[model samples]
Target chain A: MPSVDNNASPPSTKKPLYEASTQFKNWRYSPDHLAHIRSTLNEAAVGVIRKTFEAYEPGSSSNVSFVTADEEHLLVTFYIHKIGQLCGHFRFPEEVEATAASYLKRFYLKNTVMDWHPKNVMLTALFLATKTTNNPISLDAYTSHIPNTIASDVLDLEFLVAQSLRFEFAVWHAHRALWGIWLDIQNLPNTPPDFAKTESAIYDSALTHVRAARLTDAEFIYTPSQIALACISLVAPDLANQWLESKENTPIPESRVDIPPRPSSTAISASLEAIRNMITNSGKVPHVEAVREVDKRLKLCKNPEKVVGTKAYLARKAEAEKKAEEKRNKKVEGQKANDRDPFGQELGEPAAKPGLVDYDDESDDE
Target chain B: MDAVERENSDRQKSWAKEQKVGEGTYAVVYRGREVSTGRRVAIKKIKVGQFKDGLDMSAIREVKYLRELKHQNVIELLDVFSSKTNLNLVLEFLDSDLEMIIKDRSLVFLPADIKSWMAMTFRGLEFCHRNFVLHRGFKMTCQVITPVLRWYRPPELLFGSRFYSSAVDIWSVGCIFAELMLRTPYLAGESDMDQLKTIFRALGTPTEQEWPGHTKLPDYVPVGQFPKTPLRDLFTAASADTLNLLSKCLLYEPRKRLSASEVCGCCSYGSPLYIIPISSPFRYPSHPSKLPKCSTQMAPRPLEEVDGNVDMAGTGPGVKAAAPSKVKLKRKLTSPADESRTRSIARKLDFTKQVNSP
Candidate 1:
């Protein structure tokens, strides 16, 4: 028999709720905050694009375009789903899919879809998530499914995506927590003999909801365990209630949650409330809108000369060419100088002159 | 500058580097202090120049795990920031490590002292395991020492198991416990083959009956018959219970090895020291009734009787109790050849460096 010696205190994955609160404060985003950030980014991008265009056509304001938060979020969600499909085609681990989705979500949090093309960003996020999670695929392998993409396209933006997330690549998934909870139920005393098949069915259904829950911003607002519990509660409220009752007296792991081991009933209820709110909030289908104009504006930003040769673009290009020419001229001059004097004369000490004061001799005389 | 760069610069300004304390393969460590709080910190500047990739894999793993891990024994990563070319991880400043203490002949380690260290190591490891983290590499360094001593690495790892679990760390802790008893590396081998030989020699050759899948390992090889050395023979001074626990930890089968929590539960068998359960809210058991009654001869001296200034935590500055003169004399007596041997152990794990004020 397995030794029960260390069974004095059973290990658990449930941390205190405070850790969840801190994680939320660190990485979570409220809808209002997302809206505020997205709008601000859109306004800034539009102002820059407009100013650049206006430099070429002094009186034209018609070319300036803006992406609404709704349209931008729709684009983001579309690409996130695209990332999931891409991972599925690649047959990467579930973590790759989760991470790619998370990367897309996090990237859009601080950035506007107009600033960087979502298609390129989405591909980069998938490529990076694949590499980070240890199922590293070559750039060729990564871009094989997507057309008109190359290694540099994804490789160049890797640092940008990583920097946006501040290199915090660790993402918790509800699947593991849900699996743990299911096992906990099976291990409990007097679990029905035939409960295994039903438990598997319940778990499968709960996992389906968890996937749907991910398409929402529940990850930002709630911990993985909370989301998992909420997913279970949605399908198997009786089992969840049973699980809650079992956990009522048993203390939660301090590592998982920073709160008291035996949390007050109010704290537990408040968590349940937050999880329910997340599930409901996620249930609503997002309104989709056209983002063609925004995409065009982004394309124009990449190559302003394509649509209109703005004075600023022309002048900047001319200045860059002039600098390059001057750099070439300097290189030619340096080579000529080197040919004339192999050991550069300026680097050698100045020739001693009779008229120059000998400071060392003077000091010796003193 | 971009927003990411701006944020990084702000984080950089918050911590003030006092001086360069140590340097290793992957990072240069600095003694630092938080600007506002004046709290001591060790800033490990990771060398990004080597990897064409943005950040080193080990740095990423360290940050990924250490950021979430919170325990007294585990080294805490306070903040992570990138400077012009290097990634700086602001870690809790730990002054010394087990290697230094073990090497210092001036200090004598009692059974109680070893027990305390084991308790703390297991406590930290138990949390890591429960959190689904496997400290694949655990070695003694200037920072918080881990269980994966080269001499202590488990047989599975040596056999090249890519998907090993927490059992690997238990083998390391067992090696450390034995090291404490022997005052030298128990199985310090020159090479992988030699190391395996030493392990087998000490614990007998594993057959299919003993380790069902031993032959299936990628690097596994058949060794000639060798009788197992009795634990009491190796650890002559250790109690019977201590020997029993050691055997469990060093079990050939990875599945049979006691887990970190299991090790914690068995603490009563080996030492009077209270093992702190990772998840339990209760403090260390204080009641004498809960304490196991062991032979008085084998029992450790009362905690008060041990040297108070020895720095048992291994997180504080080098022990002040060891007389400077004696330590110097001991160093002087050791041959230059012996000094060179000390450098043989590669300092691969560069997590934190203790900054000594000159």
Candidate 2:
């Protein structure tokens, strides 16, 4: 057989590692695609939530005002800030803080605030980010930071958030990319004598822009490097331009391994423009008054099944618990078999012959 | 089931779960085949313990790391789904690991076989390092897929170094490389202190000059000077080129240690090329499939009498590492694999020549 590399078409032969990341392939989108996905998810969520609302009280869904995709976006943005503040409160590193916000943002892209509110999802997203970024904290310690919160509040939503995000934990934040650019910029020839001071100021300001960019649709719409460039351009346009110019005409060695693609200047400029515009326009934290209004409206529009004590929530929980109880009972019954394998009971009946073993994962986990 | 539940169950049903392979502290390993393609897979079902925490950190870390890395040398995580009220991770099925192959007395270790395994490990480590992952995983994670094997912890951890990076993995690569040749763990430390002592004993005690800030580490303990045994002496039969890689990897200073890419020999401009160069004489076969596998059924069973005991120190998360039962295990490579390997090596050499010709 031909080598797998030989089998692969030329498109991905020497692409940089980030290009293969889930953040690049799965999370990235054009502005239109991002809008379309949000609206589609919102529309579906509204329709399903409307049924639940009406089912509880006839014509109640019509009486209740559901949040629009834009409004949901506003709520999610507000929670992203909460994640940032939570990270601050916990004194998490920048990566943890940014990763949590990114997780919350990505979760809502697939899920809706109506089905799983970003308020709860934000906690779990931050918690999961801590783990993925290798700065793990106990659930008790995490929840204790927030008043009236418990371990289950964060724990229950973890799998759901992980599921919603398709278990892609590695998110390449723009700040890291910007840091790379900062390092590379130093390595560039003919730097100003005080380039350190100048670059530090620019980097600090660009870091702010990059953090703001996280709240925008920039991550979904642009690659981290592109976004980093955009942030740098926002801070010191000349520096960003010089960096691009320095990188543009670098000789592609004969081997041509790991060359970051040099897109045409116009194409890169357009992408940078879109990214910068996003960072400037919608990236600020949503006004608290505006977010509060949306949050008040969200109370009426939420999927009652997710609420703790609502009839729908109780009914859903009872059904799930009943199914689980049945599963446990069946497991207990299976445990009665006189013979057993090392791990667990066999799904099939016990073997008649001695020294014969069977394989069944029927009741595996505790 | 709603969309999420339905989707989860559908994923769960896609693989037909078969025999139990190995069980871990937090998960169970089951050998299964994907129903769609009949492709064999190892299903690691992470036990959802009495719901104090939502998921285990090990499970999350394993899934997170595996999902990002996709290499033949690194174990592939095929799928992940929540089923039977627990998380099930579908992994590529590998029947055996280096520990088993090394331990089997009947199996002869060929130079090419050692090179093949070392090369695969280096490639996998390179990928991990490229992704900015510090492959410091030291859990009892079995198989070639786990870049951080339990037996291969670097010395820094013992000396209580917190801020280490890719260099740590290079040290492990060095240890693994050495182990491949010696057929024993190069720095087999029973405990944290013992491990450090073992490492110092083999490769002399580091002075402040050798490793700057040697005394400043949090857990640094004074061990009397032991002259560094020449690596070639310890690895007596090893070629100079192989010993060169070992020294580069086993450097005392973390900063001085060769990176994964350096060991893999990156020639791209501005990349680390401390040791590996384009024209380096020694190179391992790139393809791992052509490498030797433990047939597991040796004609002469040194381990047949021991029931279910292969003395496997650590098992991969899933997959059948050693022959589970007392069934005749492969301690010998079949004659065809032997033939294919030589053919593969020749083909690789020709391919290398073709590339270098330009």
RMSD of every candidate to native, in Å, equals 13.7, 8.8
Per-residue lDDT of model 2, residues B1-358, tens digit only = 4466566667777887776666544556676889898876767677665447567554566677667777545566788887545777887665544556566676676665565555555555666666655455422114222222324666665676656676766776677667768877778766666777778899999988989996888888886677888987777777776677778888899899977666555324343443321122334332344454444431111111111212222222221111110000111233555533321111010000000000
Candidate 1, residues B278-321, lDDT tens digits: the string is 22222232221121111111111111111122221121121111
* Candidate that would win on DockQ: 2
User: Across residues A60-119, which tens digit of lDDT does each residue of candidate 2 receive?
Assistant: 888788899999999999889888888888999898999898888888877888888888
Q: Candidate 1 regions off by >4 Å?
A: A1-14, A17-25, A29-63, A181-206, A229-294, A297-366, B16-40, B49-56, B142-149, B206-218, B239-241, B265-358
Model 2 backbone overlap count: 10
In candidate 1, position B88 carries an lDDT of: 81
The TM-score each candidate achieves on chain A is 0.71, 0.86
Evaluate fnat for each of the predicted models and list the values in order: 0.08, 0.26
Compared with the real two-chain complex, what DockQ does model 2 have? 0.21
DockQ of the candidate models in sequence: 0.08, 0.21
The regions of model 2 sitting more than 4 angstroms off are A1-13, A187-190, A198-200, A257-261, A321-363, B50-53, B137-153, B206-213, B228-236, B270-291, B297-358
State how far residue B138 of model 1 sits from its true place (Å): 2.1
Best by TM-score: 2
Interface RMSD of 1: 15.1
In terms of docking quality, model 2 is incorrect
Best by lDDT: 2
